[model samples]
Target: MATAVLVLATVTTGLMAGLYLAFSVAVMPALARVDDTTFVRVMQRINDAIQNPLFGLVFVGALIAGGAAVWWHLDRGDVRWWVLAGAAGYAVTVVSTVAANIPLNNRLDRAGPVDRLADARAVRRDFERPWVRWHTLRTLVCVLAFGCLCVALSVA
Candidate 1:
């Protein structure tokens, strides 16, 4: 049962890590080449699209299952520490998202649509660099967390 839960945690975290990885590698880079209006508009649409239930499940599930993995491994000495570290790393990922990324997203959202804005470049300038930085941070932590969980699974 503990192994199963740990597997679940690892899988969910891996999914999130992959997503962040994709955004950093492919999505953002591709978006970077477009005009400011297209960049802002596409990002806005993506932000809205990503708020759906499925993404929510994987996002929150990683934390919950990582917690459960820590709980289940508490009696296993060093193994427990691995799970705990993993959970903690994921917690950082979540914190970074809420603290940094979401606020940027909110500011971009509040900037209104691209067509109506006087200067999409200004909005993009404010939103892009900071968002990418936070996202890269989250990606690194999430991948590290996934690595910790994988180590636990392998040795357990």
Candidate 2:
């Protein structure tokens, strides 16, 4: 059971890291080339779409499974540090997202339809650079978490 949970945590963290990496490398870069209206509209749609069940399951599941893996390995001194490090890394990702990205997303969502906004460029201006910066941080943190989990799996 502990092994299964650890595997699940590692896989989910890897997936989340990949997702963030894609955003950092591709999605944001592609969006950056478009006009402000298109950028805002597409970004709003993406932010909305990303909240669906599968994404939620992976996002929340990583945290739960990581926590579970940490708890399960508490008595195993050889592997506990790696599992704890993985969990800590993931926790940083979660905290950063909640503290930074989510608020930016919420602000962008509340900015309403890009076509209707008096200054679509202003809305995009407010959202794009900061969002990209936060996303980059998220990507790095998740990748670190994924690496830690991978190490834990190997050592376990």
Candidate 3:
């Protein structure tokens, strides 16, 4: 059971890290080349689409499984610290997302349609930089968590 939990946590965190990494490397850069209106509209659509069940399951599941992995390994002297580190790393990922990304997303959402905006560039300007920065931080944290979990699995 503990192994299963660790695997789930590791895989989910890895997947999320990959998602964010892709955005930082590819998506955002690609979006950067587009006009402000296109960028704003595309990003808004992406934010809306990303809130669905599959993404939610992975996002929330990583935290739950990571926590469980930490708890389950607490008494297992060899792997406990690694698992705990994994949990801590994932917690940072969650905190950065909630503290920084979500608010930016919400603000972008509330900005309404890009086509209707008086200044679509202003909307994009407000959302892009901070969102990318927070996302990069989350990606790094999540990758670290995934690595810790992988080490725990090997040591366990």
lDDT per residue as tens, model 1, 14-86: 9999999999999999999999999999999999999999999999999999999999999997889889888
Against the unseen true structure, what C-alpha lDDT does each candidate score? 0.95, 0.91, 0.91
Error of 3 at 146 (Å): 0.7
Best by lDDT: 1
TM-scores, in order shown? 0.98, 0.97, 0.96
Q: How many residue pairs clash in each candidate?
A: 0, 0, 0
User: Which lDDT value does model 1 have at 65?
Assistant: 99
Model 3, runs deviating above 4 Å: none
Q: Which pairs, if any, clash in model 3? A: none
Instruction: List model 3 lDDT by residue over 37-66, tens digit each.
Output: 999889889989999999999999999998
User: Per-residue error at 82 for model 1, in Å?
Assistant: 1.3
Per-candidate alpha-carbon RMSD to the true structure: 0.6, 0.8, 0.9
Off by over 4 Å in 1: none
Give candidate 3's error at residue 77 in angstroms. 1.6
